[model samples]
Target: MRAAIHDERGVAAIEFGIMIPILSLMVVSVTDIGLAVFRKMQVEDAAQAGAQYAIIHGFDASGISSAVTSATNSTAVTASPGPVKFYGCPTGTGVSVVSAGTVCTGGAQAGTYATVSAQATYYTLINYQIIAVAYTYNAQSTTRLQ
Candidate 1:
């Protein structure tokens, strides 16, 4: 009975078994986080690409949206149009543009401002099954059109 109690033959195996689940959980969590970060960066890059295209293309809604989609190259993310606000101030601090080429106040010109933005639906991998939580990721870029 004493020998049996003192026997530690299977101790390593028991420890390993206990640690396996924990290690696996950590790895999965890290993977999920990495994926989320990658998706976010991709979305931002896509938005910037669309904005750059718009600056040269007169801010065509369809074209901008297409550019964003193409940049992302992911079916999981959907690109949508964002608001186009104009500003007389270079910093866009005062006044808003009401029309395509007009500003609500100040000396801001209509063709002086343009913006491109993209929004995407983000799904969490870990809690997707337990609770359906969806997040929206939005990115925007603004430029002055000559």
Candidate 2:
């Protein structure tokens, strides 16, 4: 008769089988979170960029749109909510900007401040080829560059 010693050969396969699922979940979760953060930052940058362009250019909606378009360089951006009409400012009080026309019309002064909200819709790619789950993301940022 012979003797049996500790080999631990099959133990590795068992451990790996247990760890794969956990590892995959962690990786996908991280990916989802990272993508969300990235999308949020992108929208914020676009909004603030549009606002800056508006304050400097003044009453030019297309220019602001172009600025954000240049910032995002994507078709997902919608600049229609602005230039956001300004209704109360240059009177030592803050400006109240609304949406109706292509630019601020009535309540804005020469040095009045304005703000605009930018939105970006993100479609996450999750498939059996990529990961085996589904996800979607929508990010928004209200940038005050004025």
Q: Using lDDT, give the best candidate's number.
A: 1
lDDT of 2: 0.60
Would you estimate the TM-scores of all the predictions?
Answer: 0.78, 0.64
Write down the lDDT of every candidate, Cα atoms only.
0.70, 0.60
Q: Model 2, which residues run further than 4 Å from truth?
A: 1-7, 90-113, 125-146
Give the count of colliding residue pairs in each prediction.
2, 1
Q: lDDT tens digits, residues 64-120, model 2?
A: 777776787666665546655344323244444544332444544333345555666
Candidate 1's displacement at residue 38, Å, is: 0.7
**TM-score between model 2 and native:** 0.64
Q: Who wins the TM-score comparison?
A: 1
Segments in model 1 whose C-alpha atoms lie over 4 Å from true places: 83-87, 92-111, 128-133
Native-to-model Cα distance after best TM-score fit, residue 45 in candidate 2, in Å: 0.8
